[model samples]
Target: MDFNNSYRVDLREMNFLLWEQFDIEKNLLDPTVNAEYNKDFIQQLLFHARDFAYNELGPNYQRADREGCKLLDDGTVQLPSKYQGIWQKYTDAQWGRLSSPQHYDGLSSPYIVAQMIYEVFQGADPSFMVYSGFCAPAMYLIERFATAEVKQCFSHKLATNEWTACLCMTEPQAGSDVGAITTKAIPQDDGSYHIEGGKIFISAGMHELTDNIVYLLLARVEGARPGTTGLSCFVVPRYDLQHDGSLIDNHVRCVRLEDKMGIHGCATAQLSFGDNGPCKAFLLGDRENIGLRQLSSMMHMARISTGIYALGLAGRAYMSAAEYAENRVQGTSFKEAFNPRAKKVSIMAHIDVRRMLLEMKSKVEGCRALIHKLTFHQSWLTNLQALETLHPEKSEQYQALSKHHESLVHLLTPIVKAYTSDQAWRVAELAIQVYGGHGYIKDHPVEQIARDVKILSIWEGTSFIQSADLMKDKLAMGRNSKLLVVYQDQVKTSIARNRKAGVLLVETDALELSLAIFVKTHALMGTWVKEQKLELIFSISTRFLEMMAEVTLSWLLLDGAVIAVQKLKNLEDSQDEAFYTGKIASAQFYVNNILPGVKSKAEIIAKEDTSALDATGDMFLQRTDLYGKQYF
Candidate 1:
């Protein structure tokens, strides 16, 4: 029943990921380019981040959800009582600006490092993170596509957390089907537009946490074409800003607040624009109909954020379960089962409990490894692009390499979002099982963690949406998609190198077999496309995505295991011996146990059974008598 800060993180594992596994020093922390984020500075930053999460964020997590947000009669949404103090401390610490550009009063930290810091914050209170997390992506949109005047007015405030932002794309009618949105924008004389429509499920839509809320809205200009192409992006503020930076009412209102299952501290408001009066805004950039294209970057980052959020929740659950297993004494150990006088041991001693904990551990670590690998590629791409700008003579070379990294990011983003999210739910379930009945109630954090992560797979486009994107867009490149080609090549190269290293032979063999299954399944799906079996392809799309994800995690884990084996020789007497040993065990467990499932899935896809597609509505009913014997 204790609610006092149950959040936990493994700093040593984080250190291993950054320093040993990913090798940020060789990859991103070069003094010639990224001098500011050397080891000392990043390590110090992480420690400070950990302290903030434990002290300021973790303690308020349960309280925030219990109190939720309050929508006042004055049309303003008030957050949990403790939120204001937490928000002030968070913004004052400049934690929001780590990945922001320096010109915008940010530190310009590497995206991977920022993500690690984010995992800490997210683990502490994902609902709290919901308030400030969208600001950076919104700022990026403005900085990249907004006009000089618009950027001048809004960029700094968003970057510095003086104001918060949200992407207003979802309507009640158009959830994932963004092309169906009916929000309207009418041009005015002074080069501005009046926005009219209602947006639903807008996170951080209406709150008193900041003086103003900047909305990166999407609407159709009058006389524009229908569907997604007609949509235009707008920078709509809740208030109008004067030259002196004062605010005037712009008629943006919170029409209603959703009553949700979890993340209650976040204000998911139904917003109305121009319902009561004029709602003025400026279009993003000079274009009018390229809103979807402009919003792609933000959506991409949001998907990545969803994955990180899932990882955070999963990591917290695993840590909680592990801690509980070590402390919660139950029945006697197996060895003492025959003796009534034998002393009881912790649940960690039970074989089934150990199995469950290992399942949680292997999945969490493998997913973290996958996420870090994705972000590392992103960081490398950013630096490569920057180098292209600085060194024009070598621009072509940098551009080519940047293209490869770009492919990696695209290939991994959907998988990260879908796979990590799907796994997080299972991980939370395992944590609850570890706690037995207590996990089902509010007394433990696992139940809340379970509720909070359920939406990750549903929102930001469903996991099925991500899967379709992967199958249709990512892997469907004409002769061969560069994303898939590069992905396979990189994974194959790792497998080959590890095979020569001679350690983890069984694991590497299993990974190699899984890779073949993935490649074959991918080829089979391509053939289905040619054969006009689009329905079957789409039906099995999620399974295909999971196949790719399992192979990816195995590749990275075994690659890390190679490093662990190499380091263990010198660290046998050091404290890191256990850490390195655990790394190998985690990799072995996942590759041997989980990677083989790819083969079974590949067989399922090959069968192409049309039962689900062929089923009649009557077959889905629970009551056979209602359909009569003939239908049965």
Candidate 2:
């Protein structure tokens, strides 16, 4: 029941990502920080997070899922009794405001720390984590754009975990396509607006733990334009409080709960607005047309969080598999030896199992480092004053750099969300494989991990949706010339550095051939885009994204290696020596084994395989009919 212990391995990995890999301690020591922050503080925070997750929330995760939430006819949703205590503990610990500003009762921890803590909580019980994570973003929106009075009225309560928050964006007619929403907001005599219509898939829509629930409602104003352009965001609370701040039931009504594939402990509710009457709602931001834009500010953060969640889940899967492999005894042979001169040995002895486990470890750890690095950059942008003091003459340069990185973050968000989730599922699947028969049974954690991770790819956005976004929006953003130039410089610099090191893994001929293929593919993409060959561009974008991911990961590993080699030379202990040696090995693993795939993809892209698009409904029907159910 102790989720903290369950995520102990992940905590270690996260620490490495933040401190050893990203060097967040240096960033925290910048002059802009009001109080000195160091590794000790981070360690303490992590310790607290582990304790809170394990002692408070971990025990109730399975219970919450089993009991789920109940919606009474009186418009109240009751959660499991266990959740009440856990919720109280969470708030009392002041964890809700860990990343918020100090003036607002927040600890103002760095994003990497927040992310690490978040991983601990999420890995413990993502169902409960969803409520707090969702609420944090909503509070952030109000803090950033809401009026002073509004902030005074709600910010403190939300930050203190007295009030819960929900993002109400999806309606019956609209899911991922937010622009098609038809919820209406009529201007009232007061500054508030009267909200009507309903929304679906509202997580934490009706929970009993918090006194008040703040809903970030997206609605179309009366006589306004259609689609996302006419939409506006509103702060609609579940209850109308008195002058003294006592709760009275308001117009927000919970119609029903969604029966989902996973995360059943988290309430996904169907909500009706103005059911009993009109709901008074306050507008967010000044511009009515900025609804989508405003929502995006929070969405990006959510997307990043989702990516973190995926990483956590994947980490859990990897740990579960690794632990099982070390303990489970299965077969006997020179090939599948469980023990020396014994009939059975641990699954870890098997080469195939080891390969899968190592693959999972490499990807999960690599992605963890990447996510933490991105979070550090985001924190740097938010705390620009500190950056300015550190690089006075280059203050503007840092600002521009921050903006460029933000674009890169936006570009990579979908991939992180989509690809990480997808890969996590693979990890879970491999975990099941490693467990053999035990993995499929309900008694083991592998089944649960697999089921839990399955939802990640579907949530935030589907993988295909992410693919389209990467191609249509991210890759095609601005002139893309600048981005391309930046990418080329990076690849060139990496190649040059590796060549200088004289530690190249790939054959010189192979490296040159791969580089040529990449260049040709890049040129082809440019020509296709110029000719408005949308289909051709779309067809190759996923491959291009993969190619780019390979290149970026390769660069990161090489960077790690460069540092590791320097450290190894000075280190005397075997453990330290192994650590640095592993870094070098991991880099080599990526470059030698993974980088070759880029050439294969490049060749495919060059060939322009559009056979799938060419297939018609009749052809698909005929194929299915001929194949029949038995074929599947």
Candidate 3:
């Protein structure tokens, strides 16, 4: 693949989402929150982002991959030569500060704009974007949880790209199991702790992109309890600062780099702490044993980021495949297949190829809409915060208004991470199928995209972990939470609006069927919860999440379709008309062609199959050879 092949973005769809579907102006244009970020200003930012993504990042995609990071002799991760220029371009633009707190001299940009910009960057060059993944979250957590001095010391540098950060959580035995981590933090009288242990598979863990590397390390303080509850978060820098703010070596060491299957441009490191000297680590605030709780709050943001990352890859793959299909003529059109004289037409003229294209297009669009909805919900809170800041007398009212939006964010986080990541891999597979033999080779981007996106589901947390959280927490539907009831009402409202618009009845009906299935399943689960059928609920949580996510996605897509229908009524036949028309087409395709799968999933869940659990050890084949095999 020519990595510089123009990365495509659906600007019209993005505009529709911002102005029509989500109504960003109503949600965020408060005199307190936005600094003159009106419609024109936002449009200009989007246009500027388009040029930057295409011109700056797109050209370096292949070069960055071809020259990935290497571990240097002095135990530092050295970035590819091409990335220095890319890093310089990124730092100069200061896009890294998009959503950080204003105290750090950050933009405090709205989540919608930042997320949309992220999509363009990811689409342009995901591998290159990997180096930037840690900046936003670090700034967020530090500003919120760190001591004032710590925040003053670190947040600005992180936001401004003067320094970089990495989160060191996983160890040999503690991947996803934070409680099992053995990293120990021993307190010293000088107000710093000594950190000792090792972490593996850490992305951007050790790199020379900046002057100093700040590590958000999780470790068990001496005498603390076991599990995540025992864990405490710390800020451990690779090079400690002196009284005058000069750099000095700390005990942080980059032990080695992992040989990964994908994302070669990213340096996945194994870090060993307190090996050479005192690894001074500062406790986040003055608190202990609350690190897990504080960190859990940021997990949703990370998950949402992963979802957008998935959409960017899926969108790029689908568009590339579409371009390939339009030009690669192989077989005659189905109507003329029997005629010997019939000329070979573009593969897009074939019905099967068209089906594949629509499948990819609908999924890419659906995931995009889903992610945007999640951000839109979060934006309500962002605006509310500004309102509270501006009108301190009405702070309580603003807080009350934001409560439900907060619940929705909690509910949607896992779905966004799991569903989008899972589907991105499938979309990449289909893109490869669209390209046939050529796609299987390294000559195309789809194959590399496939490898890159596969890790998304595995990282952050696996699909099963997300499903468990959804079932065990969100499905509890606590008396105070509006997650279930409010979401159901939102879906009903969208269905009604779409029907009133008088368009795409078949698709709306299909979506209604999926919603109906979900309603039935929800009631069934409520009864099971009341009856205390824990086994049955746990057994089917994964399917339940899938059913709910698919229904939610259908609702969002149909909402866009309704907006498109209204827009098409006023526009003349032109590029704008075609754009609106395509929105309806993709929306209808997903509801009719893909929504039925929800019914099947719901039916399977209703069956409560337990044969897999019922099986005895003797009934399953045991691999004696595998058991006997050993590694030294």
For each candidate in the order shown, give its overall lDDT on alpha carbons: 0.90, 0.74, 0.83
Ranking by lDDT: 1, 3, 2
Candidate 3 structure quality by residue, lDDT tens digits, 1-632: 34545467777778888888888787666656777678888888888888888888777766666677899898877776778788898888877877776777777777888898888888877877767777778878987889988887888888887888888889999998889999999999988899989999988888877889888888999999998889999998889887799998897888889888788888999999998788888999789988888778767788888898899889989988999999998988788879999999998988888899888988888888889888887878888887888899998888888997888888889999999999999999999999999999876678878888889998888888898898778866212334777788888888888788788777888888888888788777777777777678767877788888889888888888888888887886577887777888888888887788898987887787887657788655554555696333
Candidate 2 matches the true fold with a TM-score of: 0.90
- For residue 421, model 1's alpha carbon misses the true position, in angstroms, by 0.7
Write one digit per residue (lDDT tens) for candidate 1, span 71-174.
89999888988899999999889999998888889888998999999999998999999888989999999999999999999999989888999999999899
Worst lDDT 10-window in candidate 2: 1-10
Superior by lDDT: candidate 2 or candidate 3: 3
Give TM per candidate. Answer: 0.97, 0.90, 0.95
Q: Across residues 1-632, which tens digit of lDDT does each residue of candidate 2 receive?
A: 33223443445556656666567776544535645457887788888888887777766666666677888888788776678888887888888887777777777777767887887788777888787887678888998888777777788777767788889988878988888999989898777888989999988788888878999989999988887788888888888766897877778999999887667778889999997887888888666767777877788788788878888778878888888889888777565345677678777888888877877776776676667656776776666656677669988787787776676567567767776777778888988888889889866666777877788877776777777776666655213455556556655666676677666435333444555666567677777877777677776666776666666666666666666776777887776676677667766666677779888898788787888668677755443455474332
Q: In model 1, where is the ten-residue run with the lowest total lDDT?
A: 623-632
Which ranges of candidate 1 are over 4 A from the true structure? 477-479, 621-632
